[model samples]
Target: MTLEAIFGMASLLAIFSWIALFIFYPSKWIYQTLFSGVLIVLGIMYLFYLFTGIGSLADFNFDSLEQVRTVFSSDEALLAGWIHYLAFDLFVGMWISKDSWEKNISRWVLLPCLLFTFMMGPIGLMLYFIVRAIKTKKLNQSPFH
Candidate 1:
């Protein structure tokens, strides 16, 4: 498949996973499907691209922004990087959803956090932290706590 098609598929999969979380909150099947079905698939793709496209890590070091940019100069490397972001962000979103459910945080309040997490990973997580702190009335060491 073309890289563009792969990107589109991954994006849609993540979106459907998020929607499933809303529809099936706290379901083991949903978590399993996301982790095994979505994340693992994405991980395999990431490895394939990283090994086949990026190749020899000795040639690249992420010690600086320029180095990072150099590594992502290849389209394959860029796609791998983008997939990395998509997978991790979706994982983080899943964590947030599960955690919020455990904490009894309303889904209405979580919508924005999830949306922000989808568009901008850290920003959505930060928003979740704020929401969590406000909802729980205490800032804990771990997000899960």
Candidate 2:
């Protein structure tokens, strides 16, 4: 498949997953399906493209911005990079949903966080943290733990 086609499919799937979360908040099946299904599929695509593209990259390295730019210059590598963002951002969004549910945070409040996350990953996460701190009153709680 062409990179463009793959990109479109991935984007659509991500959007569908996000919508599912919004509609089916706190549903176990939704979480399982997204985590075990969509995430795994994206992970496989990420690995396939990363491996396939890295071998052909003459200057593949993460030592500097220029090296990273060179690595992503190719279509395959660029697609893989984009997929990486999609997968991780989706994962973060899912985490936000789950955590909000646990903290009794309202879905109405989560909408912006999820939307920002889908559009720009970290900003949404930061927004979530702020909301979480206010709602749960646990400012020091680490998201990782």
Candidate 3:
């Protein structure tokens, strides 16, 4: 398959996995496994593309936006970057779902975080943390002591 096909498949899987986890199934270990597998596939595909081309991991620079843009000018480089986002963001989304469930946070609260994570990654992580913290604080407070 072409790089674009792989990219699209991975992207769709990542997005669908998170949304399905949030909506259809919660606390399913198999879903977590499936999502992690997709992440690993994307990472491996990106690494493979980097190896075949000129994306030197040992000397990659991120000192400036222009430099980053230059690096991602190549199709392989861009896909690699996209896969990086897919892997990390999906992992974070998975974590949020699992952790929130353990803490008994409502699914409604996690849905927004998961959606944001699928779209913007770190922002979703931050939002989930904020919500988690607030819920945790509420749980710790005395109701009528």
Clashes of each: 0, 0, 0
Query: Which candidate, 2 or 3, has the higher lDDT?
Result: 2
Number of the top-ranking candidate, with lDDT as the measure: 2
TM-score, every prediction? 0.93, 0.93, 0.80
Worst 10 residues of 3 by lDDT: 136-145
- For 1-145, candidate 2 gives per-residue lDDT tens digits of 7889999998899999999998887889999999899999999999888878777645679999988987887788898999999999999999999999988899999999999999999999999999999987878868663
Score residue 26 of candidate 2 by CA lDDT: 89
Off by over 4 Å in 1: none
Model 1 C-alpha lDDT per residue in residues 1-145, reported as the tens digit of each score: 9989988887787788888877786788999999989999899888887766667888568999998888888888888898899899999999998999998999899889998998899999999999998888887737545
Model 2, TM vs. native: 0.93
Candidate 3 regions with alpha-carbon error over 4 angstroms: 23-25, 53-59, 138-145
What local lDDT score does residue 134 receive in model 3, on the 0 to 100 scale? Answer: 96
Q: How far off is residue 47 in model 1, in Å?
A: 0.7
Model 3: which residue pairs collide? none
- Candidate 2 lDDT (Cα, whole model)? 0.91
Q: State the local distance difference test value for candidate 3.
A: 0.75
